[model samples]
Target: MSTAAVPDLAVVASPWTLGPLTLPNRVVMGSMHTGLEVHDDGGAGLAAFYRERAAGGAACIITGGIAVSDEARGGPDFAVFGVDGADERFRVAVQAVHDEGGTILAQLFHAGRYALVGGMVDRHGDPQRAVAPSALPWAAARGVVPEELTASEVERTIEDFAAAARSARDIGFDGVEIMASEGYLVNQFCSPLTNLREDAWGGTPEKRRRFAVSVVRAVRAAVPDLAVTIRLSGADLMPGSTTDDEVDALVHDLLPLGLDGISVGIGWHESRTPTVQAAVPHGAWLAYASRIARVVRGSDHPGVRVIASNRMTDLRDGEAVLADGLLDAVALARPFLADPAIVSRSVDGRFDLVNTCIGCNQACLDRSIIGAPVSCLVNPRAGREVAFPVRPTTQPRRVDVVGGGPAGLAAAVDAARRGHRVTLWEAADELGGQFGLAALVPGKEDYAATVRAARAELDQRGATVHLGRPATAADLVGSDAVVLAPGVVPRSVDIPGVELPHVQTYEQALRDGVPAGTVAVIGGGGIGVDTAAFLTESPDESLRARAFAERWDVTVADDVLGPLPQRQPVAQRTTRPGEQVTVLRRSGKFGQGVGLTSRWVALGRLRDAGVRMVGGVQEYLRIEPGALWIRDEDGVERAVPADHVVVCAGQERLEHSLESALASAGVPFALVGGARDARSVDAVRATSEALEAVRSLAP
Candidate 1:
């Protein structure tokens, strides 16, 4: 295969000036809530996390939001400023990054009404209440209303921002980025929906934006040498919020405040528009950044660059976006988590070897939302660099990786990289097993890229791959150890009419498209929902993009984004024209196994496509040539019009009978992925276990 990059990525590799700072490239490792902010190891683990990405060639890395006050925390684990023992933590991380010739920034943040974690503890170990512009109760906060910030409190908050910036500079941070976007405290103060005050900080749009301007003015005065930037919302994506002109006007308000850059963010936490989910097309939000850049360039402060973030993960897409000459830089968060060396690989023109973020959010966003430590599904060693170093093993051994699915692929690559001689055996002709099928689904093309990356890595590490070869006891005779991961098969349900010609397994439906007619899918797990999404998606790329826009109401235009961008109401989107798909589950939500952050997006996609989701299906009455009958929750029998019934009730382990046979042959082996457990198809767990299995085999 050719190693040459198709697109000329010279533009992404080029440098651009942001005020006083000259970045090495246009790729910025955007800030993410790592949940390591509250790690038990003080700052050692957090230092490792940022230093690894810095070592991987990130021109500049922005740390996750650091709360200026306890009342401003987005969650409990959020990093809080002015707290005890914070300076040492900041110094440790700063030293680690500086040692690698990298610049790190502290992101000053406040949550306002969005602080739902019962508020972070104060510097004196006393609890504080969530504070906001108004005494509004957030829906997720369960009736806990934020205490309306008094005028005095608001003034103190601004001072806190300045103090935090000064403290960050004192701790050796290169700069500080204000977290004023994505419906955070500053953004909430700028929106009418959240800010219901009439004091100097409220009243009109100007007053609503005064809070942000004041923050910038104070921070600039406190630390004039700090490379200061702000993350402002190009579009809040919230209904009845800041207008497009208001957002544009606010950009002009901050241009003269000694700002260096503006990183454009989109969508609020409660917004209906899905911004960063996999369902969203790559670079869907770039136009918003371009809009902001136009405002900056048209003004006197054109030197202050604009950054495009959210869904702009791929380096190729980043190159294209930058080549079009709209924005100055592309900020990627999860992509860095997936592959820390993403920028380096692109710089070396080794794009094929980069581990692509599939945008599943299984580990990163999902865990962050629930206040759990964040990691990557594709790369399990993301934040655990200190625990799982990539140093070559002193003793090399012959390792046979049985099964070339995701688990086998990850294990083979890791083992080979650790100085083990590996041979991969697959029952199928191709490598990816379940993941390849998942890639067929709409908006999931990146899933296949993961398999491709692993394959290339295995080859680069000198691992032998045997396609269309199934391992047996004889094949494992000379192997010092084995990593068994034969993967799974479609689970069989003994329901009536399964033997009919109309019935097919998920594997069959994914490989061969179903006949044109209403389709009925059994089960409502992640795989089931994926199968349903695949059946209903348009085959043409243009048509698919169009449908996605219609369903989510994406604005790819250069016009300023405002409130209520969704063309169709939530209720009306359910009635949109599409192929009829019925997803039946015995109980629970439609996307049961999916992560909380993405589960709603997947279900919403199905709902928008006119998919009939029938939960609490008491009984599967029967199936005929053209339809299926089922007992509803109310014990009412109904006929679902369907030409074909696809079974996606999950999977059972494929019994290759190799595990026992290999053990009897006196071969030491470890079971991973489906070979070890078949309760459900969890790619996150499977991949992590595979990496751990390799570590266990090390001498």
Candidate 2:
């Protein structure tokens, strides 16, 4: 497949027609916490980050969570849009976006009870009280005690919104979005759980809606010409919280104030539904937006547009929602991170070539929480556009890529895009290596999307993909350079009874789709743990305890056990009554590489499903009558019955063969992915190394 003739992305001719000014496009780059703006020079890096997105194709890019005042700053690194006389820095940022033919919006926010006052003071040079509707802090860990804003302070806050809007207009911004969602100051006041005030600002649904309406009215009055959008939570998702009816009433009341659009998301931070928030399918929150759109469109505010965002990554789904008239525009977060040219691809019908976001949340939101620069898990050049622009090399070179996994596919796509003729060879017919298994896990369908996108990109970039062709020294003989991305092979750990008829590797099990009656998994690494979780039935505490006692010489005093040391938190425990399975970890630690949020959920599920976890398995030997004997790490030998065993000891580097072949053929080469190293840490490190290697060879 050749994609050399692909044209540049199309530009939006008219974004909006607001009385006099004609905006560029309906697509809005919603504000997210980029964390880059915490640095001095008023977040110049952050300014450039937004500018690049605008340059790439966003009609309007909203700056990160910008505080309306010092006390309202949520995080240590939140950008301050309310700094007195800081209009010059914002002007520079707006000019950068304008120079790139894109409009910019300032997102005005107040953290309310969500403010990390101590951290804010440490970073921004001052600490102030966080004003909320009622005197209740949002999170206990942040140490923020919310103070009720007095009548005078409430009036001042209304003025603050107006002032912020006016400042955005003065600094050359085309619009400002009032953030009343995700449990920010306005959202906190809107929720019944947080807002208990009596003086016309809390209690009833109408009262709780007062603060947001006042803010919106004030902002609209301050900047009548600016395109003002209000971001609101369509559903609070908390128990005893604001219902959908209340949200509809709130939007209905605010519609008369001349608001331009509404952006809806789910939950406050504390009440966030992980299934809806992170793990569920794409466009999971579309129903919430659909409900809001139905209400807004049904009301007297017929001209007002609706922007639907929240896991709306699939172009087809987004287009369907648009065609259905459920939304005027779809705001994407991770998809834009994966490929800023996503809209362009969708418009051009090259949707398959669009690199999709896998919703891992590791590099994006998780990293932000940990105080690191934002980036994409798959696409390395996210948020670093200034430093790592995609430009063609002055001179063309021939490159050979061994293996057809994520890393190899990435290198091939990037190299071909950089004006290189590339040939990618895979020993197997399939491209994705371990990712093929990763896709099988529940709530991981997006991994398949990432794989398909990479393949499409290689095809579109004019790179030759040779399937089922293992490259040798002869194959690399004439290549100018080679990239050794041949991934690892499963390691064989010698243990007695391991040669039993049913023992097999994870790859073999996946490939063959074997079914076993009773199974035991050996090893405690990420792959091992995942394999154990996959093979074992659901969690059941009583049944699991009975099985453990019967099969292995172990006794469980408690029905529910906490996560092992160095493991992810376990949320709940139950048992799968009839399922027969036991997981024996050679290492003392369990759930080692799981993410904090996922670990809790997965562990809870496993415990509830009756999977027996036996830690500290030492020596293994075959016993009489087809049984397996094990010596505990405590030096006590015991026998455990197992009908089948699965080895999940994990993979090791298989690059020596490819490296030797390349060397023997005198081919200049780079190494990438797990082929570069055996450990999981090699994934990112190898990608970075491969990029550097290509840059060094570029002419």
Candidate 3:
């Protein structure tokens, strides 16, 4: 098999000037909170993490948002630039990026109303309250209305920003970025929905913009030598929030404040809009940045560059956006999390080997929200880059990895990379077991790239991949060691009438089209919800044609016989009026195995599609001709009518017999993935476990 050639990224790989510094390339590592500073070492873990991206060819590495004041502090674990000994603590971090010829920026932030009272106590050893421009809280911050900031407090906060900027410059940072986006302190003052006070800093657009402008001007004056940049929200995506028209005026007012550049961040944390998810189109927010850049171009400070960010992962798209003069630099966050060396690999003409960001948000944002150190589902060594360095093994041996899902593929690649000969066998015709099915789900197609990246790595490392080949005990005889990742077997619930007509498994319903009229899925987990979504939301051709006409801004002619085929709403693609899907689970809440970042979207899609959801079924009585009887949570018996029943109860690990066979064959073996634990659903668990297993093996 021949590998495809890599794309030419000479223009994308070229240098560009930002203020007084000449960046090595156009790619910028956008600031992202990793939650790795939970330790008492004062950001050693955080610094090392940033160093990895700098070494990987990032031209500018922006540190995660660090607090600037005791009242504005988010948590004890967060990096603080306004506190004592801050300069000494960040010295090593600044030197690391400089040593790699990469410019580093300190993202000075203040949580504002988003700051929790408990977090304040943890950070300052004294309880403090949150203060906003007005008494408003984010949608997620319900029941925690903040006390409005007094005029005096606001002035002090501005001074805090200046002090933080001065501290960053003193610590050897090349620049300081005021985080004014993402519904934080400055954004709260900028947005109409959050800022309502009739003071000098609120009420009117110009007044609301006063707070952010003051911070920028103060920071510029405090640190004359360091570059001053501001992160602005391109779109707040909230009702009554700052609109694009308002942003136009806001940018016009801020450009002359002695600012060096602007980074356009999109959406707020409380936004109902899809911002960074895989569902959002790549470079969808470029227009927001382009509009801001145009505003700057018309100003006296046209040299102040606009860095386009949010959902920008593709190199080709970045180059095109930059070529069109839409943005001076492209910022990527999760893509760097997936592949720290993405820019280096692209420059080396090995783009095919680059691990692309799937934008699942499973391990990154979701974990950080729950107070866990952020990691990546595709890349295990994201935050632990310094801890998990791949080195050559002491001795080489033959290894067999059976199964080609995430675990099997990961193990095979690890073994081969460690100077061992590896053979990976899969019973299916293609790789990616459940992960493949997940990618096929609507709005989740980005997951397919994960499998492609793993396959490319396996091939590049000289691992033999055998599809449609089931490995037997006899095949493991010549192997020094065998790693069995045989995947999972769907476990069908034993309902009395489950063997009746129109009854099938979730896989069967998906592979073979479900019967028309009505469908019922048994289980409310990610798999079950996805199956229901697949059944209810499959696109129709007539609907697609109408949508196409509307998207192209074309006026379609009415049909000669009557009106043209009517378009169905994207959220309500139920095929026909009578056709519906009912999803049932043993528990009350749905999306059992879904990640925190994607759960709301998944459930929202189901709700918008009008899928009937029922939970807390005490028992499954039986299946009848047109109805299935079950005991409700309250011990009341009920029957749900359906045209077809799809079972997505769970999976059973079937590695016992294989284990016995390998033992009888005198082969030492280890179990991985679903073969070891069928309960493990997320790819993070499976791949991490597999890598640990391979890392411990004696050659």
Top candidate on lDDT is 1
lDDT minimum window of 10 residues, candidate 1: 567-576
Candidate 1 Cα deviation (angstroms), residue 475: 1.5
- Candidate 3 residue-wise lDDT, 384-483, digit = tens: 7556665688788888988888888778777887788889999999998877776655555556667887888888888889999898877888887788
User: Which portions of model 3 show Cα errors greater than 4 Å?
Assistant: 1-11, 41-44, 82-89, 119-124, 138-145, 477-481, 538-579, 624-641, 660-669
Worst 10 residues of 3 by lDDT: 559-568
- Model 2 lDDT per residue over 513-621, tens place: 4465666666665565566555553223234334433432222222113211111122132212324666678774566656544555455445655767778887765
The better-scoring model by TM-score among 1 and 2 is 1
| Higher-scoring candidate on TM-score, 2 or 3 | 3
CA lDDT of every candidate? 0.83, 0.68, 0.77
Which residue ranges in model 1 land beyond 4 Å of their true spot? 1-7, 82-84, 557-579
- Score candidate 3 by TM-score against the native: 0.88
Could you arrange the candidates by TM-score from highest to lowest? 1, 3, 2
Error of 1 at 389 (Å): 1.0
| RMSD to true structure for each model, in Å | 4.5, 8.6, 5.5
